[model samples]
Target: MILFFGTRPGKTVITQLPDTACPYCNQIGTLQVSKTSSYFHLFWIKLFKITTDTIAECSHCKRVYYENEFTEAMRKELP
Candidate 1:
């Protein structure tokens, strides 16, 4: 029998953050909080989640930031 298994990432938009200064693009209101989870897949179907990650996305410059890079204020804003 042939078995197929792999890992996949699942993402969720936590929230649309309010207008805030973007360190990368120096823009306001262009950042959104998102959550991503890595999952194990079996036969092309998701089996169980392995790990999770939180990040921020900038619409202007299209930059992605991990949770460790988030400022104190930004951390508080996460949902």
Candidate 2:
């Protein structure tokens, strides 16, 4: 018998951060937050979520900010 199991990334949820500016670009209202969840799968079937990652991107300058790079203003906008 053979088994196929691995981890896969789930759908991404995007939300706009109102009254927030990009930390790198300093552009207001151009910051969008994306949340992605990883899940364990067995034979192409999702079993359970492994972890969730949060990131912020600037539409103007296209800067990506990871969880550890978030600023005080960025943290407050997350749900």
Candidate 3:
């Protein structure tokens, strides 16, 4: 799935992902795949597989959101 790993303005660089516990998966690796940041106008999107970034598919919910997104939310929630 394509994830926003912090932007450089115009690019939406996407890394790849797989269906396993990220820590246990290890079946994937880093490969850079990107898109136009303009597309982010959609609040949520089904990211394109570019490379893995510690992201794993939930066996139950099967919902995918960036781990970074969750972390950022928690950081904001803390304050």
Candidate 4:
């Protein structure tokens, strides 16, 4: 028999910051905050979360950035 074990990244859109502008695209009301988790999986079944992080993205430019890269105003806007 063979067993498969590996890790994958899962992402959830926490909230939309309609008031914030995307730094990369310079687009207004396009920034969104998302939570990402890395987890181990067995046979494609998720086991447990290994790590987590928050990110900000621009719908217009498809730019992704970590929470620490967000400005004070942008950070406060996250849910």
The whole-model lDDT of each prediction reads: 0.84, 0.92, 0.35, 0.85
Candidate 3, residues 3-74, lDDT tens digits: the string is 444212344445443322223323333222233333222235533434333332433444444446333322
Lowest lDDT sum, 10 consecutive residues, model 1, at 11-20
Q: TM-scores for all candidates?
A: 0.70, 0.88, 0.21, 0.64
lDDT ranking, best first: 2, 4, 1, 3
Q: What's the lDDT for candidate 4?
A: 0.85
Can you give the lDDT of residue 18 in candidate 4? 86
What's the CA error at residue 19 for candidate 4, in Å? 1.8
Best by TM-score: 2
When summed lDDT is taken over every stretch of 10 residues in candidate 3, the lowest stretch is 24-33
Residues 1-79, candidate 2: write the lDDT tens digits.
Answer: 9999999999999999978988777889998899999999999999999999998889999999999999998898788
Regions of model 1 farther than 4 Å from truth:
23-28, 60-63
Q: How would you encode candidate 4's per-residue C-alpha lDDT over 1-79 as one tens digit per residue?
A: 9999999998665788888888777798888788878999999999999988888888899999897799877977765
- For residue 74, what is the lDDT in candidate 1? 74
Top-lDDT structure, candidate number: 2
Off by over 4 Å in 2: none
